[model samples]
Target: MGAPDFEFRADLLDQSNEIVLVLDPDTGEIVYGNATAMDVLGYDEEDLLGTSITTVTGFDDVESWAEHLPQDEDADHRGENEFVRSDGERIPVEASVSRTTRDGEDYIVVLVRDITERKERESELRRQKERFEQLFETAGTIMVVLDEEGFIERINDRGSKRLGYERGELVGEHWFETVVPDDVEPEVQSIFEGITTGERGGVDGHTNYVETKDGTRRFVQWHNTPIHEGDEVVGILSSGIDITERKRNEDELERYESFVKSAKDVILSIDDDGFFSYVSPASNSVLGYDPDDLRGTSALDYVHPEEKSEAESGLRSTVDGDGDDVTREFRFQRSDGTWIWVEAICTGCRGGGSDDVGIAILRDITERKEYERELAHQRDALEVLNEVVRHDIRNQLQLVTAYAGMLEGDLEGENQEYAATIRESGQNAIEVTRTARDLAATMIADERVASISLRHAVESPLEQVRSAYSDAVFVVDGAIPDVAVAADEMLESVFRNLLQNAVQHNDKAVPRVEISATVDDVATVHVADNGPGVREDMKDDVFGAGETGLKSDSTGLGLYLVNTLVDRYGGTVHVRDNDPDGAIFDIELPLAE
Candidate 1:
């Protein structure tokens, strides 16, 4: 080429957007570089001119680059490789090489293009694929990708392990044929078809059973989405979790709810504000109110006016979660506005939620309360009768005995005997009245148990009986043990009645009685009398109501009261025939703790 022609071509190449380089084929040196080449390579013309091609290209030498070039001079050679910049940074580039003859001289022409953005795009695609694979395999739930024809394209590690299969065993297998049971295959296939045909988008929370390799089935909850290529649906991606255990828990909860609904007691829950949060269906039968009607209403509204304060206080402690279980009885209004007694047991829970709630179980106690009321009335009436006998009857009997005694001294012969009989009968009647008074006092007493000294209990009654029966002899076998027993003021009456019975019923002229007591785990007292021995069959019936021992005309209230009081103190009393003659009354009482 002429110099003008070479200058024109060189100037034209410099103006081109491409990075152009002219090289010496044999030397592998850059003969010329365009302006674009200098700017992209980060170098000036002086820094690049005459530089060896190996400095910029990855090739080691001229012969190495020649081997990759096209052998035909007319053909162009293309390559994708990196170029080292002046600043020592390497960037990817595309290169084209061709050999041409100018004025019979061989020369090489090379064109280069920067491809950093394109290479970055490729790298980003690889990174996104890796991230997707990591998420798909490591997910907790089963994930699967299926083709439009229902073939398994991909199954995650979790899905394969859950189905008892190796990593790639499920790939390329028909999903329904391999995993779905025969009974539900047709139905599942229909849904899959809808997804692929665009008739339905996908499934959300659809449940079905999947058979494993061992033929055991597991119920799964599925959520699926369609995978689209352009405007056409190509496949489906599904996620599933085993819901068998959750279903069983739900069934148990349902059964428990049914039981609560049919229970006879009213069950309810209360919030922190003392209002009812939930009420069981049994409220209708138990409290004469509908469950819905009771909900959201204050529980204290139905309580009796006198009991509202106690009810409110209990509610506060329970909802605050600071109190133990509480059981209390109070009057509650029925649906008809009449009051009925109810017993409520309430409990609380801590850390349950924002407002820790309380639960109450209420039962009707109206029948028991009514029975208690009737007993109170009967006791009051008996108390009035007891006062009448204690004063009126005893005073009248005393006057009759005094008048008969006066008559006895004045009369003679058979008249004197008649006066003595009248005096004795009046005295016996007076003693009977005292026994009756003791019985009445025992029956009406509340809180009837206390710790009593055995020694005092026996000594006081012994002295009284000895003074009353001057003709009878009373002796203590040994000193009475000074032990505390579980008894009350009525305890003295027990020994008094026994001592009186021993003397009054004696057939001997001089009645001899011996009292003794021993203490171990309990206090046992024995009262032995030297009298006609009681029959074995009558011993048990002696304490029965109206069944007197040795005296049929007398009321057996004294002996009966002895049995009742002993029982109240957690003790027992029994009569047995003494050795040779008379009877022994044995009383065993618990020791006071």
Candidate 2:
């Protein structure tokens, strides 16, 4: 204690710019002041040394400061308050007051700093932030700021207006509570959880009803984003876009799709990868496979072995985008090992995010195919029978005519009546044989299958009928557009037989024949006649091999041959009454590829 630690005292105040003052704690009197303390307060060292610290820079409220100060000498303390300077100016300051002992002398050390500029800048920043909040509150779209807990911390003016609520009503409430419909709560919650967990960044295309304060609901599409602070999520930001009209349209589309899927016809979609992406449940009853089993499986796998090559070629054409529509008649394998005949129509185009997809629809034609086979067999048998009948009947009829000629020359009186009867009977027999040969040849040749144009096939036979019946007016109505037909020969036979029967069997004063063609998903040929309609009792027998009208003397095989040929061509033949009392025959045939 020889130098009284003068050097230690200098070192203590030399390193820091803070104003340091030593005071007598018990009397609140100033005992010493540092160089910085004098400069900061505009005071001289001698002026502060003798005066009490409170007298030089008095606390704004001495009674309050005195009461807040710690009473115990053993504890340290800190506080903030204003002080009046020598000039009588008020300044906010933070004072750290600590009780200390130096050389066994009890005293208090006060460290102080002026915070006037800092406080001014803080107040300016708060004003600017308030301005920004005011601008956000006046926007048009519903804007919401949410904390990490999904609570609505702030909402814009438009949001409040649309929701029919005041701004305060929304703050502190869950953002989802006002927007999410009760029916969609589960879905909205799941999406929210996903966003919160960082599983999804944003979600669009969700349409839900939002309930307003007025108890009305409106459809809206929400766009959401996760708010991140550095690497951590702090909250979410959401914008609502009203889409009530769009939602209604979407609902209508879904309803239409549902109806199509439930239709009796099988509706399906095949991808460019040659796989069935969508197959209706009706496929189970039609194709012998569960709809689930067919999905992602190649549709070509079900094609019959014999028809696989053709089906594959058609599929390739579709995949290459070379054909818009390609149709083929093939057999499809059933679960029972047997094959069912089918006519498939394939339409090629881009699908499923790629251009390599193909789609096809198949219709079962097993019954039509079976009928065709039976008709072909019957036609062949009838041809052989006709050849024998023509040979024997012609020979017998020629002998009877020759004998009738000789008897006419040798007879007189009563014998003449017998000769006349024999001669007429022989002539009738010859005519019957001729008609039978013509009908048999038509049936046999018509059984073979070949592709031809519908217009040409139907018009050619109609031309012949028009030529044969000069007195009967023949009018071909409706345009017979070009179409592909598998069995041209048989269909031609059917058309010719129908036209001839109409002309020959009609009792109308002016016999008229109408032949028309209609092309659609399938091609149809309609042949009608202005004739006394077929008797109801004879309609069923008209298609029989040997059935003929009670009034007609012809070999009654015309309608029978028409039905046979129609069936051989994988088509149907049905009878109907024409408008003005006549027979109408309707035939439907598959289109050519």
Most accurate candidate by lDDT:
1
Clashes found in each candidate (C-alpha, N, C closer than 3 A)? 0, 4
lDDT of each: 0.87, 0.75
**For model 2, where is the 10-residue window of minimal lDDT?**
1-10
Cα lDDT tens digits, model 1, 1-593, are 21113565778888887788877777877878889899988888888988878888867877897786665588998989999899989989999999877778777888999988888999998898898788789988889999999999999988998998985789999999899999988878888999999999989998888999899898889998999999999999999998878877887999989878888889888887888888998888778899899999999999999988888778778877776997778999988888989999999865546453788999999999999999899899879979988999999999999999999999999999999999988988887898888888877888557888989999998898898789899999989999899989889999998898888778888999999999888899999999997787888788887876564346777788889889999999988989789999999999998
Error of 1 at 401 (Å): 2.0
TM-score of each: 0.58, 0.43
Residue runs of model 1 more than 4 Å from their true location after superposition: 1-263, 304-330, 347-351, 354-356
